[model samples]
Target: MSTLARWLLALFGWKVIYVPPPAPKAVLIFYPHTSNWDFFIGILTRSVVRLPARYAAKDTLFRWPFGWIFAKLGGVPVNRRERTGLVNQLAEEFKRHESFYLVITPEGTRRATSSIKSGFYRLTMLAGVPLGCAFIDYSRREIGVLGYLNLTGNQAEDLTNIVKLYAGRRGKHPTQEGRLVFAAESARSGD
Candidate 1:
């Protein structure tokens, strides 16, 4: 799978930059998720780098037969309807796993938005893990894991830094890319 993924990415003129060393637990959040194609690129990159990562998807996709396959591919079912306590559940998963890398799209959707969902930040903080910032720079045809940022438990400051890190990075649809902003409650809560 690694070899095939590498070949396909090379054939398509796409490249992956730094892949960090394996960590016991980390939240890998990618920015500029403006296209559905990002999921395919992310899957291939996961294979190419052989990273042990799990991604959250809507729980509806986990119904019947396909659920097993998705789970095998490290897909975690997220029940968006019951939004509360998801971060705590994910944190528990991290605690149980000796090594876990959870992939997240802070934007929560492909559509344009002004702010990122604070779930990723809250999850990492609860799980006591660093947040890994990955980027898909469409302009450069590159997908790279820029490594992890250790959160200081200050939501506003941490989110601000994360947004700054993604500055200058381009998404496939520039106009649809979300700006990373957090809610005022998140900024004040410090939780």
Candidate 2:
């Protein structure tokens, strides 16, 4: 799978850089998710780096035939309809697995937005795991996980560092790329 992913990326003129060692448990925050293609690119990068990561999706996506396929591809379903302790569930998942990488797109959408969702940050703080910064830089034609962030639980300061990691990295659709606003501002503005 890794070989196939590498070949596909190379065939498409995409390059991976600064691959980090797979973490036993961590949150992978992929930035600038400005296109549906970001999902495919992210999957390819995950395989290329040989990371055993599972992405979170609404429980609805785990319904029928596609559910099995997504499961095989490391999709973890969450019931978003209610506050069902998803963070706790994921935290337990980390405790259960010797290795787990939970991939999240804080932008939470393909269209341009004012700010990022705070769930990813809250999840990491609750799970007692480090947050990893991964990016798809369309301008550079590169995709890879840089490394884990040194989070101190201060949302604004920590987010500032995360944003810094993605400095100069543009998305596939630059116009659609959302500005990563702080969680407090996002909440206050009802984004």
Q: Each candidate: how many clashes?
A: 0, 0
lDDT of 1 at 103: 90
Per-model CA lDDT versus the true structure:
0.85, 0.83
Per-residue lDDT of candidate 2, residues 109-145 (tens digit): 7788787877888888887888999889989899988
lDDT of 2 at 157: 91
Candidate 1 yields a Cα-based lDDT of 0.85
Where is model 1 poorest over a 10-residue stretch in terms of lDDT? Answer: 182-191
Q: Give the TM-score of each candidate.
A: 0.90, 0.90
Candidate 1 residue pairs that clash: none
| lDDT, candidate 2, at 47 | 85
lDDT of 1 at 15: 92
Model 2 alpha-carbon miss at residue 6, Å: 0.8
